[model samples]
Target chain A: MSGNSNATASGAIERLWKPLVARSRSKRALLLMAPLVIFELLIFVAPFLILLRISVSEAGERGTAYAEGTWSADAYANVLTSEVPREVIVHSFTIGLIATAIAVAVGLLYAYAIWRADGFTKSLLLFSVVLPLLTTLVVKTYAFRPLLSPTGTLNSLLESVGLLSTPLEIVPGLAGAIVGQVYIVLPYAVLAIYSVLATMDWQLVEAARDLGASRPRSVLEVVVPQAMPGIIVATVISFAWSVGSYAAPFLLGDDVTFAMRVEGQILRDFQWPTATALSVVMIAAMLVVISALVAVLSRFGGEVEYA
Target chain B: MRRESLETALFRAGYLVVFAFMLLPLAVVVVTSFGASGQIAFPPAEFSLTWYESFFDQTDWLRAFDNSLLVGLGTAVVATILGVTAAFGQEIDDGLVGRLLAPLVLLPMLIPPVIFGVTLLVYFTEFDLQGSYVSLILAHTLWATPLVYFVMRSVFRRFDWQQLDAAHDLGAGPVRSFVHVVLPNVKHGIFVGALLAFIVSLQEFVMALFLSNHTTETIPVVAWNQLRNSLSPMVSVVSTFLILISLGAILLAAAATNLNWLSKQLS
Candidate 1:
């Protein structure tokens, strides 16, 4: 009877200690996460807040300190009403749309090919796609300058072949910018779409074939629908990236896009208030695009099932 | 049978064309790097290593390379340490604090880097941290930590806690159990994350452009300035070197980790 009583007492102590141990474990976890949390707060969150505050203030005159008092909507008002600002926004969106569309269309086809190809072809294709992504953006941009220059490869080849009467100017323009942007972003689209393609069950294709569906019909009806979520994600991410991209446009676009305009205002002109306001607009636009993408995906994409 | 044959032929042709489209420009760059004329041209009249030699001769280029190496290595070490610890903490707690903090950690990657750069520029100037190597390292660390966190978080999720508990029950201390049991399990993830951080810091342009002074300009920033101020075939040499470095690192990392498995997981 005394031994039984001792056993019950030990069991009661064990039950009490278990919760304490779990709590301590969680406490240790929180301790681990603190550094990242603090770093983000100090660097990311704080600066963004500062930019937000600056965006509300009015721009000072050239070489004058920006007035720090009386927060107003003047900077935003200027961005909305100004021709340069409006055109920049439109140009940014247009470039983003065209680049994303091309990227997705090409990426979808590429991913499809990769999925059906032999092992060697699959590896080669995958490597080629990711190689550009691994390179520095500055390097890629500089490389594009030579390729797209009037006296560069494409024009030189055309002229040599007697196809062009004159050198075609390609670089330092919107065309060059779009081409460079597309090259940089295409890998992202391919990675996104290929992931979905790889996950799809080949049995579905076989089943459709048995049901008398053509290969193209099977892909359209079954494959495309299944891959829609990934496609949407790819489009959204590519668009967002294009919209905010500075390096390609700055190097290749020759001050043609909104991103370039923003950079110019901040870096060259030192118009902090104007740049801050433009930044806010860019973020708002991105948020809108993302929200719309989420809504559309939720409605039509269903749940993405990966194999 | 005819239809099947035709479909296969079409698919093969399409694949070849797509592959060319994807690789043609980069191939052009590599070929042009060997140009004898030391000018940007598509098909070279002659082949020589003159541009490559010129690249090596420039002192600024060498200094810029050194800067890139230092910044990249620094960011990798610091970010990986912080990211690993944070990932560990989040995994252990799985509490409200972890959930709330998770998105904040990821915000640097998700938000447009322009905003991040500008914000850092303002913040550093405010704190009088501008033009310092420490500031640049800190910025790059913030930029890289998210990638490390993502990698380590997944690693921790797959880790078996029971193993650690077993080690502890067998009379191992907490630190010993971590070093012997947990470290080995997560080593691949940590290595890959560190490699990625290194690569990112090496290639990063926008933030470095704003943050770095003349004395501390990284390879990318120096390249950007060179591109803007003067058109030089020497730029191609630098670009090619950067490409080679990144490719070497990626291949090395792939050899270290099961990249195929990791890519599958990311997908």
Candidate 2:
């Protein structure tokens, strides 16, 4: 087979080959990438540009709106002055920060467990970390509805355990939002931090232990410091995701984030201007967070390459 | 050493509780789905498959499920193609071109899906393409592509490039060599990429919320609507099915790449 093919190869200067050889090899990558690049620019970038334009445009009593004379900042002004939109922005940030804290705390344990355990335990730990992602966020949060609702699983369990005399109102508020966001962001935290630790040299930690430091001390001094950059990255990932998230707060009945606000403005009020403005604000906030992400990636590319 | 061991034991116990918290919601949901009792109670007095049956009985749930499956499959195929192409492009040109393209390709993942949802909602309304499956699938493809590209890129990076050279030297054309030589080696990446793409599409909610309407609603969208209206046992039944599919996907991913090897793929 090789001999026949080799003969064909050696004598392959055919009528169909001249231009192909001249132009094909060098332009192969460019051709391969053309479709994806075009799709992104059209479907992703163009829409965002449109969103920006739409924010300045008006939304009338009838339907979608366009600018009348020049671009207007009325939508922005309304959002700033309005009670709901302004509070949504601040509340989302607060939830994001809280969610980031919870994610880091739980995620650190999961990462540590994965890093320490060897065989089956490691996979189990890994499984727990990733299992939340397996189901939709809505489904998980929906399940939480029962547990956080009156006479639900959590209340029943707590009551049966003699811990509570009255049912706790854990759902449909900021606390529920935090719990839901934590559930969503925890995996990301584990993944981000674990990705860094996976590439890290373990010899240093062992050396610290050998030099008479306790395990906790050694970890605090050696492991935590080395993994700090990753922790920061993980924190930012969780925070950004939470801030930009719609599902968690929406499901928890705390649908007051800028993301959810955009949806609400569109669906409820049919007000494209206010929604677009809120979207722009959300994108701006995300951009700020993303810049932080970019900064970390640039400074610590080697640490998070696999992530 | 004794004190440190005690600390380690305490941590183990703490993590046990944390993991329990992790599993609690899912367990409660699953358990309740099989219960005979009404009103979303815990530790049921009896067990039944009433909810699962009711889920099948409803046409709305079935239609939404069908739409979800259709869109998920479409997104998976589209994302995998784009991902494979981008991965190939990166492999072929690992210079400034690759570096420049990386962030742009990764833009969908970096930015929030809600942002894309909002942008597309407005854009679609403008272009008169609103509420179409094509529009929704395209939006989801944007979300799923980056993951596939990353997975495939890693798989390609770890392969031996010499095998391809050998195939070429043996007189195979580029396409033939890639099919006969490279494809076999990278099948795992393809498998993982496809499954990851599928899962992303299956579980996607935000984009579908903005893009889909009555006819084209995905499962997550339907579930969200149902949850907003009332807590039905059918939601659990549907969620349970999704969880089962996710399990299948994970097992498939594990089979595609060696579990231990893939576990440390992040490293």
Candidate 3:
């Protein structure tokens, strides 16, 4: 294994150093790729490089940053030591984990339902999932207000119906953030899980049932295992999505998430070091998530080929 | 006639409940937009088009709406060119270019928009491009092209390249063959991608908040500002308008293209 890796490493270096191979690239292909590549380099790659530099940068006044100084790890140190950053990071994870769990639960059922249904029923079900996304997230999240607010329509209705004695403060807190994030992320989870479930062999579940497995047992043993890849993908997607959430928490409450803190530090306090530090942390989290996603997807890709 | 078992019946009913849960908020917004009571409330005492009228009367809202339209149009055009080019480019050399470029081009999708927004704001400020339509469109284009790429990749995957080969063999040049043969076949993908890109830019506000100036303020940013200040019924009016127009855009594109490409690509 070591010898094979050594050969590949040296081969990679040779490929990197070779200009003759680069010259062999088709002119037409290069021309076609020119616009997108240049656009991405300018707009995507450059900005991200700037972001990395800014993260390591010494905290400057609001407008001018990294104007004169060498790179510094002071920002990372500040982020690690800050109470707000620590609490907010933990808070974001807890919210993301809880929301992803809820989304997975509902999304699995919805995806399974879509898989089982035929014809227009399937379309309607899928459309319903996608419909929420069609509207602006603010619209959907704001709509939660009338339902969850103290003395809002829901509480009024509940009071009249004798179901409750007082209003609930659910819409402007952690609960509200979870609801909004789950609402936003649920459709993705459904689609992710559905992609796998749609191709599953239902006959296996039927066989299990025929061989004395109960319905729940058959699903638990057969269906879940078959859909495990998708479930895992959906969970990771939703978790990443929830962790990166800013808008939902922005509408629900203030300074409620790590994302909000990043925004706040930049726009509110003009604390570049702390904001960039927090962003670096978030970016690290994103990289970890992306690597996990890529690793699982590659493994899943291998499974398909082997099958 | 055969009937579904209790389990199947319950499952279908469960889907209905979930649908209700998902769509009920939108229903409330639509209904509340026409609230005649002048206060935002569900199941209002009466209904009116007053808020809709107010939405039209306000210059700030109209300018924001127009900015969204103008920026959406710019973003759609720029993103389509780049996206279609990249998508078609990926087909060349049997995927060499795409394999090398995928990580860079697709990174924007994975980056948190807030982080991206901050990054753009910081960069644009240094470059003196802050609060300009060029910057806004570029930021939007960065966010939107990947969607177009995905839609067109699936379209290209299902496409047959022999038609283009035939066109090339007939003495038509590369551009001509693309415009004549490949273009006709992939127009549905182009249409779907452009419309989705337009919608994505129109709905995106995070970057807009960072990148847009007073003159270039998009509708979502305007709406976010409005919502942050207070939960006004006028917000509902604007949202209801957006919802209607989006639905109209989808249906128009679907009908005009004579293909359900939008729904198909989305599914």
| Best by the lDDT measure | 1
- Best-to-worst ranking by lDDT: 1, 3, 2
Interface RMSD of the candidates, in order: 2.7, 3.1, 2.4
Instruction: Give the Å error, residue A96, model 2.
Output: 0.7
Q: Give the best candidate by DockQ.
A: 1
Cα lDDT computed for each candidate against the true fold: 0.79, 0.78, 0.79
Docking level of model 3 = medium
List, residue by residue over A1-307, the lDDT tens digit for candidate 3.
Answer: 9999999999996785365247535557656767998898888888777777877877775475443456788889988997878889888877878888899889888888888887787767766776676667778788877777776787888889999887777768888888888988887788777878877888988888788777767776677767777787677778876887888887775446887888888887777767877887977876786577557654543232211
Query: How many residue pairs clash per model?
Result: 0, 0, 0
* Residues forming the 10-long window of minimal summed lDDT in candidate 3 chain A: A298-307
- Per-residue alpha-carbon lDDT of candidate 1 for residues A182-249, written as tens digits (9 for 90 to 100): 88788778877888888888888788789888887777667777888778867876888888787888
List candidate 2 segments past 4 Å from native: A1-25, A65-70, A253-255, A289-307, B260-267
Better of 2 and 3 by TM-score: 2
Model 3 lDDT tens row, B35-127? 987567887779888888877789999999989999999999999999888878777644455676666676677677888889899889879
As for DockQ, the candidate ahead, 1 or 3, is 1
Q: Which of the two candidates, 1 or 3, achieves a greater lDDT against the reference?
A: 1
DockQ of each: 0.51, 0.48, 0.50
